[model samples]
Target: MKTLKLILIFCLLFLFTLSFAQTKGSFKVIVHKSNSNSSLNKVEISKLFLKKTTRWKGSKQKVEPVDLVDTSPVRENFSTEIHNKKVGAIKAYWQKLIFSGRRVPPPEKKTDIDVLKYVHENTGAIGYVSNSANLKNYDVKILKVE
Candidate 1:
């Protein structure tokens, strides 16, 4: 009976760990605190980042989407999860848009700090970072993706 109890405890712990484990390719979208967007799902984020939508529905503030460098893992994950496309594919899409004179891609920042700074300074700016980022000291708002 003791052995069975131990085994059951181990199983419960394993399941709990698995449940709380960070999701694969997980990312967080952040915006300036002034933006007042509490949450945005994948479609709204994709549209904003892709420049398909220009303004925040809340305050009608123009949306200024920012991007991390293409080489960052967060950027890659964000490209995959939010855009449902690889980084190269997103690049190609941007290229087509640029050539068609339809839209310009968001400015790419070199690091998470830089992206955060840009978002912090610009009321309309929105950007993404890794799930592990420590945003405790930052004045940015993280928008939930459901």
Candidate 2:
């Protein structure tokens, strides 16, 4: 009985550790290389993505936030970690906005490379991609999330 209990405890601890690691998904926020801001806190980032904030601070340039497809795992993690909401909830929020004609969600790209391309080409664009994406060749700036 003692040995069995010890094994059970070890298994539970392993499972807990695994879940915690999985919850901390990896991704990076990026913007056009010319964007002046170097970093932004989560709240600021969230506002930009949600369309609550329309322009970059201290600049007349309009902010063009982009999103990954609803089905992308990077989008799933970004929705949870940055927006503190699930992807489905985000979709619903955008749907209501579109129905009311208040706003539209950021354009969704199908892949990280596509997002990189968009951000690189648009001076006011901001986007996120999986951490594993090859950004070496892209002329984009990785924003530090505070």
Candidate 3:
């Protein structure tokens, strides 16, 4: 019985570790270099992505949030970390709004390059990309998330 208990505990620990690893994602929030705000809290970032805040403070530029394709791991991590929800839940939120003609979800890019390109070109755009994405050639800066 003691041996069986130990085996069960070991399996539980392994499952816990695996689950934790899956929830953590490597990503960085980025914006056009011209944006004055250097950092934002998670709530502020969430508001921007959710369209609750449509305009940049002290500016007339509209906030354009971009997302990675639904299947992308970066997108999954982003939804989990920033919105505290799964990607499907976020999609559902957008779907309800769209059904009512209220709003639409942010545009989704297929890859990190596309996202970087979009955010670099749009002054008010905000996006997240994989931590491995090279931003050196892009006219964008990473926004420190607090």
TM-score pick, better of 1 and 3: 3
Question: Using Cα atoms with residue i matched to residue i, what is each candidate's TM-score against the true structure?
Answer: 0.81, 0.84, 0.83
- Give model 2's TM-score versus the native structure: 0.84
Highest lDDT model number: 3
Instruction: Provide backbone clash counts, one per model.
Output: 0, 0, 0
Q: Measured by TM-score, how close is model 3 to the native structure? A: 0.83
Candidate 2 residue runs with Cα over 4 Å from true position: 1-25
Per-residue C-alpha lDDT of model 1 across residues 58-88, encoded as one tens digit per residue: 6998999999999887888898888999999
Looking at candidate 2, the ten consecutive residues that score lowest on lDDT are 18-27
Give Cα-based local distance difference scores for all models: 0.88, 0.92, 0.93
lDDT of 2 by residue, 29-69 (tens): 99988899999999999999999999899886899999999
Instruction: Record all residue pairs in model 2 with backbone atoms less than 3 Å apart, i.e. clashing.
Output: none
Arrange candidates, best lDDT first.
Answer: 3, 2, 1
lDDT of 1 at 94: 96
State the lDDT of candidate 3 residue by residue for 45-141, as single tens digits.
9999999999998776899999999999889889889999999999999999999999998999999999999998999999999888999889999
Error of 2 at 127 (Å): 0.4
> Ten consecutive residues with minimal summed lDDT in candidate 1?
18-27
